[model samples]
Each structure stands twice: as structure tokens, then as C-alpha cells.
Target: MQNPPLNEILIGDCREVMKTLPENYISACITDPPYNYEFIGHKWDNSEIQRRIEKVSGKGNKTLVKNIPYGSGLAGGVRNKKWYQRNRHNILDYEKWCFEWGEQLFRICKPGATVLVFNSTRTVAHVQVSLENAGFYARDMLVYKRSSGIPKGVNIKQQLEKKGYEQPEKWDGWHSCLRNEWEAICVLQKPLSNNYLETLLEYGTGLFYAKEQFGGFQSNILEGIQRDKTEDFNVHCTVKPISLMRKLVEIFVPRLENSILIDPFTGSGTTLLAAKELGINYVGVEIVPDYLEIINKRLDGISGLQGMLPLSE
Candidate 1:
């Protein structure tokens, strides 16, 4: 099938949805897929958590709830009451799902197309191996880092309470040990007879926007872009930061002049929005209805997307 409407959101499983598209249709894919665990939540909803926080501090204080979700580290493990059991159908089948979807992804991607899959330390190896076995070449393994200036939260109130202070000040909430970022971007490229430059030409349409900002070293490992909840989707699964997505597009899948970006696991449509800002075409498939709504709202206020058509057509 021809790809869905450009700039629109398709609500469905990516594995099933991507199969409908034509081969070699996408120039590249920038994805932050679900981590196979249901606990990760749909798209990082921390409003309830923030509300609790604000209640703890005073309703009028914005600073008190600022870091409620992103905190000093990745949020706690996703808690699904039925996760470990086999009674109900769960995406937690981990390796099986990884390999199955990895194969599907391999099939859909164009030859020499680049894919950047983001994951945490725990499942990084599984993702890497699955992709490799499915025939994608692993080009690089890079960490997404945060600045050392930021504090962590491994131990805040306990230390302060031990010292006889009733409560550790908010700044004290910053963990002394800088929190290592939770996600890693594993870059892969499909094998092709054509040269790498040809592949770059096909994908680098919007790369110019981030090239000069990289300070000479074209390292794939990125750092310090915090996910702002205010600008983020409230879905349970953690969404990747838009700045990080922009850099990923520029560095890996440079925008192709005539082609559209495709994101199968388009959580909250971060990839689509990034494509919009870069003046590229895009198709996003989201499995969750709430996330699709979030994507629409995000696209609505973007001035550049004023006349763009939704991919759901």
C-alpha cells in the first residue's frame, strides 16, 4: 500500500501498519519505540504526579513541581500488575517481540536506509542483537548524556533528615552524582550496493540545521537535552526529547529533498513534529489513541504545519 497521509497520524501497531507501506518508500526512520515493558506507561504522564507534588509544596509554586517527572534519572520501572505472569497477553514477551518486530522493521526499511533505535541499558543488548541478526549493520552505539551540572536524586531527604534538618531544600533534591542518561541510540544501516554518500544524499535533507552546532566532532553520542514535561505528551511511555530527535535526524537520516520521514513507533509524534520543523514530509503510526490525540494537538500550534496534510488519509 502507498504510505498513509503525509503529516498525519495512523493509530495502530507499527508492525502491522508498516507492512502496508511500499518497499523503499521511507528515506529513514527515527524511532523511540516502546521498551517491551508495559510499565513504561504510554507517553510519560506526570501531571498527576506533579499535582501531588504541588499539593506537597504549595499550589502557586511552579518550581516545586518542575522536575516531577524527568527527575534526576529515568523514571522508576513500569509497574504492571500482570507483567510477570503469562495469563494475559503482554508485550513483555521481550526477545520474541524484539526479534519479530526487528525482522519486520528490516523488511520495511529501504536498502541502506538508516534506523536509530533508542533504549535503556537493560534492553540495549537485546535490541542490538535482534537488529543485527535481522541483517541491519550496527554502525554505532552511543549514549545520550546529561550535563554534570545537573544534580541527581538517589538520596535526598534521607541524608538531610539524618543531619537533623526537617527537610532538604529543593536544590538539595539534586543528586550529587550526576544521573547518567537512560537512553542509548543504536544506529544501524541496511546493506546496499550503493555508496554511503548516496545513502546520505537520500536522507540528509534537514541536516544543515544541526551541523554547525556540533562543534567539529560528528559524534553520535549526544548529551544534556532535558525532556520538558510542559512541552511533552502525557502518555505513559517516555517520549524522546524533540531537540534530541532533531539532532538524530540531522546526524543520521538527513532530510531527503523529495522524500518523507517515517516513524513506525511514533509516540506522541515527536519524529513527525521534528520533520515538520525541518520542512520535510513525514508519516507517523501510533498504537495508542491518546497519543494520537496528543500528536494532533502538538501539530496544531506549529506555524509551519498550517497547510500540511494529515498522514491518516
Candidate 2:
């Protein structure tokens, strides 16, 4: 409630931690929390796999798993014992948990505040319903186009053929199956008694630079920074690029100089780091202790940030 000592991470459950904060304390909330999908938890190393990539052939190629932070990956295999337990039972359980948090978030944010929630196709509809029920109006959906890279050594098609499976002669985009190239970013706002669109439009129009760079930005969706993040722990859980958040804040809330940006489920604190870099104040809440530590270390590494006890110069 006492602002939790600026630039420091609060390591605890968001719902409980949020209770210590004042009502309408933040100007905006941007986050990508756990979706109910029970996403696989390990990264796939396809370096030894074969590929027939054509579209991205001319582009600067980088290995999909290279340079990514360790400990983050997809969900699959029995090794994900802990994940299986946490996400067992009915699918609705996950959605219910999200709704509970959504309500809490709505209560803490200022009126006319913006909340950006990122989710997958499997859970986007449920998230939409949850946000609406929480009293926030659905504003836009931003889409980030990604390029899935190929592995180096093994022959996946050949392996399938050898197994007597029907393998297609040509491979289409990743999404033709279950592989996703873009994620849905649901934007919501706590409406003002009067016209809310004035501020909404002002925020939307401000993202023109990113719109122009990534083509035109859409109210419901927009393109994202193209990169492979399967190896990055902070990015492994269907995370949105910091670049995207940077653009969104820069365009929609240019005067963050005096506003507080809150991310209740601050996984790796990407939003917090972005806000500090942009000279905007921020408060974050994370359910995992290690994640909070990661954010603290990240903030300490930021040189321009002041009025905080940074671990490093």
C-alpha cells in the first residue's frame, strides 16, 4: 500500500499483493499472464532436423533456440510433472482463475485506464468474456506476425515418411496446423462516464510510428517484433516482445512521465523495464519469487534509472 518501495519487485501472489495498493493507483495495466491452455513447458531443439524453408531464405537467418534464456520452453512430455498437476481437471478452471484476477485488476486501475492482456487463440474468447464481465470495454486486438525458423540436422519429413505416415510434399505457414505465428493482444478500458473515445483515439493515434514501421496498427491487432524466444525464460510463456509494449506505451500514453504503469502478473517485468527506460513510473506484482528477482536484477542493470537501490552501477 505504501508504494512497496519504488523500483523494487514484490514477490508474492498478485491478488494478495494488489490488496496492499490504493484504488485507481495506476494509469495503465499491461501484462501477459498464464493462459489456461496448459502450454507445453520445454523447448524443442530442432537443430539437427531438416528443413525446406523458402520464404525466409533470403532474410537474415538466426537459429530458433540460440541465445534464448534457459529454463523456458513448450509443454509436452511427462517430464512436465508439476505443470500437469497445476493445470489438471477441467479447462474452465484456468478461465475462472483469470476472471478472478481480471476483476481484481479492474478495481485497482484508474477510470479510463487501459489494460492490455495477451493470450492465445485457445483462450482469447474466454479472456474476452472475462474482461467484459469485469466491466472493461473491449477496444482492440493487436496481432504480431512471427517467422518460425527451421532446425539444422534431422529430416522431419523423412522421418515421417519412414514411419509410413502421410507427409505433405510442401509445408505451409506454422498456423496451418497448431503452430502460431501471431498472438492476440486484447486491449480494454475502464470507460469514463462521458466520452472515453477521445482519450482512446489519442492513444491509438500516438502509436503511428510503430504502425508505419510495422505497417498500420489496428485497434484489434498489430504486427510484432520478429524473433525466436523459445529459449528465453521470460519469453518462453507466449510472451510479447518488449518492443511491442514500448510502441504501445509511446504511442498511446506519451506522457507516462507522471503516470504509473502497473503489471499485476509481471513475469519477467518486461513492461516495468520498458516503462523505466521511457521515463515512466511503474509498479509490478508477480506470483513467483524468482521472477521478481529477475525483474529486480533487470532494473539494477539500467543505468539511467534513479531513486532506486540498484544492485549494479
Tell me the spans in candidate 1 whose CA falls farther than 4 Å from its real position: 2-5, 36-92, 147-179, 197-211, 229-237, 305-313
Q: What's the TM-score of each model vs. the native?
A: 0.66, 0.65
Per-residue lDDT for 188-303 in model 1, tens only? 77776366556545533222223455467665567667775656445544566788777776665544455567887787777787788776778898776667678888877665
Q: How many backbone overlaps does candidate 2 show?
A: 21
Give the number of the best model, judged by TM-score.
1
Off by over 4 Å in 2: 1-6, 39-89, 149-179, 197-221, 224-240, 304-313
Minimum summed lDDT over a 10-residue window in model 2 is located at 43-52
Error in Å for residue 277 of model 2? 0.8
